[model samples]
Structure formats: C-alpha cells, structure tokens
Target: MGQVSDRRRIVISGCSSGGKSTLLDELTRRGFRTVEEPGRNIVREALATGSDALPWVNPEAFVRKAIEYASESLEAVRELNEPVFFDRSSIDALAHFERLSIRTPSDLKMLGEACLYASPVFFAPPWHALYEQDDERPLPFNEAVREYDWLRLAYPKRGYAIIDLPRVSVAARADFMLRTLGLPLSKAP
Candidate 1:
C-alpha cells in the first residue's frame, strides 16, 4: 500500500448513472484537483458527431478515445500540486467491455496496472438514485448491476480501494475521502 502524496491519484468509478460525477464535484469543492470523466466527454462529443450510431460496430473507437483522453487527463492532473481525483479511469473501460463481454485489450491491461502502480485509488459503488437513461446511457438495470460487480472485482485485483459511497452525501463522501487519504482540505472560501 502507498502512503498518500500530493501527486497521488484517486479514481472514481461505478455504474453508468452512479454518483461518480457527483463525488468528483464534491472533491473539487473540498480541495482536490481533478480530471473529468473522459468517457462522458467522449460520449458527448460522439453524440455531437453522430459517431455513436453504431456502438456495436465500433466500440473499439470509443475505447480508443477513452484511452487517449485518459492519457491526456492524467497528464493534466499530474501537473497539480495536490492529489488528483478522476471521475473515472481507463480501467473503467475494461469493466465496460466486460459488462458487454468484449475481450479486454492487452495494452489496456498494461495501462491499468501502470496507473494503479502510480497512485492510490478510489472507486464508487453503483447508486440507482442517480441512474436514468439517455441514448448514451442505455444499459438495463441488470446489466448495470453486472457492470458494477465486474468493476468492483476488476479494480481491487489491480489494487484500488473501492470507496463505498452508498450512504454519504456527495460532500461527506469527499470529506471522508480526503480524511481517509490524509489530504488536507483547502482553506475556506
């Protein structure tokens, strides 16, 4: 296990509509610098460009975008002078594929380990309250549950502590995480 550091990274992940984004927002409010969810940004861009018309046909394209964006996000966050929070990481892409039964790529396997090896990590549990559907969020409840389960399994195997965000409010969750990581809170605004 690694001791906390200014450069340590915390990765938040869960089912499609879970409070991962919510928690990340709170993390920012509390003091941690962060990386936005590349998947979300990619999906938004894809929807704008109609690149998602054939998700089944070119899922790899999405994966590649996630990987590319994750790399950029990590680089940006690494420039911060404090621990960084990620809405999610490239590892989540693996979990996404596992939920859909797609084969995991060898490079992603390496990237997951590399990122995990470089920082302390966090993951959120799926929260149904935050879940709703859109063209970009089409997984069924059962599938989302399976994706959550698979993600829980996948992350720990790579050395992340799945932060149970089931009961805490977004602010409290962020406070608890900073306390848990021993990262000092920023001065009051």
Candidate 2:
C-alpha cells in the first residue's frame, strides 16, 4: 500500500513529563497534520490562573479537563482525510485512571476502543536525564516509569503495535517516526 493508503491514526504517549510534546512538534514539522496536547494547555491555564496547583491535589479535575480535550482532539483526527498524529491521546488519559487510582467510565473506554490508530507508537520513556518540572507538575521519576509501563501494555490487547522510542536528539527521533510511518521528511526541530 502507498503511505497514504497505509495511513492510520498515530498516538505518541508516555509519562506526564515524557517527550510527547517534542514528538508532536516533530510530526507536524514533517508535513503530517497533528493534534496538539490540549491537556497540557488546560493544565497550564489552570496553573496560570492558580486554580490547580498540585497535580495530586485535584487530579480528578485535571483528568476531567484532559478527557474533554482528548475527545475533541480525537474527533478532529477522525474527521480528517489524512493521517494525523496525537501527542497524548485519551488512552494515555485512561492510563491516568490507574496512575491516579480513578476508575474509567465505560463510555470513555469504548471511545478508546473504537478509535482507528496506527501501529508502533513512538513512546518516550521517563528520562531522568531529560525529565524536569515546573510548578503545575510534580511527578517523580519512578511514578513516570510506572505510567510508561501502563501505556506500553494497554494498547496491545486492542491490537495497536508499540514502537519503543529511545532517548535521542529530537531531530533523530523525529526522523525515526517519519521513516516508520512511511512519511516524507520536512524541517526538523
């Protein structure tokens, strides 16, 4: 099949401070339409407004906002005629169900199960070398690793392939995703 014919939705996920944003930037730069992480934007706004400080303090609220954003993000992708990249899809949010000890609603689980996606995600591990934090985020390194594990397994039972992404320069990792997705290259950032 041609690259376009082989097209499927791609989701790049990892822990909270994982390189999801970095990967999203790469994919968009490579000429593929991409859906940015609305959850991050929401959390940033919340923190900026001082509505939510600690991710642990009001995880339920934060997760709810993220779920709403993810639904919108996925709908936009599903409506597209071209392959799209999602920085952190709702499945990642579902993982948070475990990460935060919250139970996922049946409808949300169904949404994740129904969405069409690409094989072999580009997942960024929790890198102590690269992981840092700002005020709104305070997840420790071990917690991030635990989240990473949850992500790596949850999709496979649903038939999506996993592509483990190692820590590398942003340029190289982007190049890897483009090649794996059978997409042409564009500017690398």
Candidate 3:
C-alpha cells in the first residue's frame, strides 16, 4: 500500500474529552469530508448489545474492533479526491495497544505501517475544564492527560509531526486547523 501524498487525510486525535469530535464537526460544517470516531461507535454498539468489546471490559477486543473500523474507513476514502478529515486513525489504536502493553496483532501492525496517515497530525491537548464523562467515554481527566502524552510520543516516532492545537474556542480551533493545512477558511454564515 502506498502512502497518501495529499495532506487532506488529516487526523485530529488526542485525549478523550479534548473536543476532537467537536472539531471534526466544525470542519465538516465547513465542507470537509470526515470519518467519525470508530471507537465511540464501537462503544455504543457494545453498550447496546451488552458485549465485552469495550475499552474497560475487553480492551484487546476493543482495539481489534477499532483497528478494523479505522482500516475500513481508510479504504473507503481511498478513491476520494477531496481532502478527507479523519477523527482518528489506526495510529490511535496502536497507541492504545502500547498503553495497555498489549501485543499488537501482526495484521494491525502491518496496516499501520503500510497505510500511514497524512503527516503533521493535529493534536488536541487535554482540556481539564472541558473534560466530561459520558456513556461512551469512560476515560477520566487524568488518564486523558496521560493518553495525550502517549499520543504525542507515538505519532512523532512514526514519522508524523504532532501539531499541538492551541487551547481556544471551538471555532478558533477549527480555523486554526484549516489554516494550518493552507486551506481557505470558511466563514460562518
């Protein structure tokens, strides 16, 4: 598999409750195509079925599902010409495996190594004040910080630059991301 040369396949990843979903929504509202977070959707599905494929319950299963989700999304967008924003990608799954000290499956590692994301990933740092828990997100605020640190290290080690997004309003953050990509900013109507 060849790496995507276009920087449009952006990955906005960070700790839980760091406004990744919100930022992705803002970008989508500005007319950017996006791939939603597969982990959250998997969590929702697990909750609905009372399955053990959850971050807190069976983390390995959760990681496997997440990688599969991310891989499918990546493949689905392969034919698109427009720059598509990914809420998270396989890298996040790898990070999770590393965090848990779980051995990453060979297939998952191969996928991650082959299909690298667009460089200079936009990282949403942990926001203490904005951190909140919900049904899908069981990660606590402190753990979110630790996750951010892990991601910061993980992405760079994989040859991707981590662009730390400033702690600002959601709109500003959205604008910052577009500007960082050298894309024209869409004005709010």
Top candidate, metric TM-score: 3
Q: Which regions in candidate 3 have their CA more than 4 angstroms from the true location?
A: 1-7, 187-189
- The TM-scores of all predictions, comma-separated, are 0.82, 0.82, 0.92
Best by lDDT: 3
Give the higher-TM-score candidate: 1 or 3.
3
For candidate 3, write residues 70-160 as lDDT tens digits. 8888888888876788888888888888988999889878876665688889988888888998988877888879988998888988999
The lDDT for every candidate, in the order shown, is 0.69, 0.71, 0.85
Q: Per-residue lDDT tens digits of candidate 1, residues 24-86?
A: 777677665767887767777788888863344477778767776777777666666566777
- 10-88 in candidate 2: lDDT tens per residue? 8888766777787777667677788887666776788778876235667656666676777767676665666788887
Misplaced by over 4 Å in model 1 are 1-5, 53-57, 105-113, 117-120, 187-189
lDDT comparison, 1 vs 3, better candidate = 3
